[model samples]
Target: MDQRSELSEFLRSRRARLKPEDVGLRDHGRHRRVPGLRREELAQLAGVSVAYYTRLEQGNAQNVSVEVLDAIGRALRLNDIEQDHLTHLAKGKAKKKRAAACRPQQVRPALQQLMDSMDHVPAHLIGRRLDILGWNRMAAALLGDMSQLPPQERNLARHVFLDPASRSLYVDWHGKAIDVVSILRLCAGCYPNDPQLTALVGELSVKSEEFRTMWAAHTVAEKGHGVRRLRHPVVGELTLAYETLKLPDEHDLSLVTFHAEPGSASEESLRLLGSWSADQPVRTG
Candidate 1:
């Protein structure tokens, strides 16, 4: 991917999502050619000249200062992950200096132990590309036998969007899909040169129109905590709060765990489901 082109397009897309009224500009109720604030208007908001702002959007701000970047970031409403991505692109250090890092063959032993210990809650380990590294019996049951997929197609994002069954598995499929694509965009910005990531993006972009549209939107969001609602074939609908913790010493691995709030119907459902799942045979790759 061309870093310059990516940077330019990302900036322009973000800017286009915001309107004059969004940033406190009074709508003149006059006809406008574009959807969002004009170049001069944005530059004015960021306290920069039109030429300087235009140069930045053109990916030509070679000597841009940190303060200036921060100002532009605020103007564009860039989130934490988007801000970091912008800084990284501006510094021109996207290409890996060393050989591409090797992907892990399995989940770390400690993480495996951690997942196993969560007897009632569903937990799993996944890579940056949403590839399942490992999961407990509860996780497997809740997610519906993902191991049945070919090893290469075990990615959550791919299965969720590309596989038809997944459409009905999630209660709120559109919202979940958006979150998946947004997280993928964040990962792409972080590892622009990863071959595996590039291939995943290419495959999804071609295979799924929803993924393609969302990817083109250039959205970025951090994934740390959220509530997920799923319709399990066996257990009916379940709503669980999940926490995602990035593992130390591992660049792209994270531990995701889900638990229903106490005394709720969801919690009762999870308990029954976990008991049932624990009785099933475990599959190991």
Candidate 2:
């Protein structure tokens, strides 16, 4: 992907989502050509020159300072994830060349044991491209049997977009799909030259129209702690809160654990699902 073009589009998309009144600016009587605040207005809000902000938005500004970027982020009303994404885009051009082939990341046995110990909490390990590197039995029960899928098909983004079962698995499929695409966009900025990521994006873009449209929006988001409503085949609907923990030493591997509030129906359902998963034959690869 062209980093400059991606950066330009991302900034434009964010800028278009905000209005003059959003930042307490009075709406002028003049007819506006664009949807959001004009370039000059944004520049004024960010305390930068119109020409400099314009150049930054156009992807021509090569030396972006942290303070200036932070000001722009605040002016744009960006969240923490979006702010991080902006920083990534600004620095992405300086990334060195990666290896021709992306190396497969292995889950540590200790980490696997840790996941297994959380018997009631559905947990899984995901690599850079959202690949399901490892998962516990409860995770398999909640999100479908990852062991049944080929390694290449074990990506969360792939399953969310291509797998028909995912439509039934996630209660808010469209919303989840949008979040997945945004996460992928953030990943793309971080690893602009990863061939595997490029291939995955190309494949999904061709296969799913929804994925294609969301991908084109240029939104970027880091995966964070959130609640998800999932429909289990056996246990019906479950409202689970999940936390994404990034492993510092694991080469972009993250452990995502899902659980439910105590004494809730979802908690009971999760316990039942855990029992059911425990009864099934343990899967070995």
Point to the candidate with the largest lDDT: 2
Candidate-wise lDDT, in order: 0.82, 0.86
Residue-level lDDT for 106 in candidate 1? 71
Residue-level lDDT of model 1, residues 181-235, one tens digit each, is 9888877776677788789999998889999998899888767798889888878
Candidate 2 TM-score versus the reference: 0.91
Spell out the clash pairs found in candidate 2: none
In the order shown, the candidates' Cα RMSDs to the true structure are 2.0, 2.2
List TM-score per model, in order. 0.92, 0.91
Candidate 2 differs from the real structure by a C-alpha RMSD in angstroms, to one decimal, of: 2.2
Summed backbone clashes in each candidate are 0, 0
Give the C-alpha miss distance for residue 113 in model 1, angstroms: 2.2
Off by over 4 Å in 1: 96-105
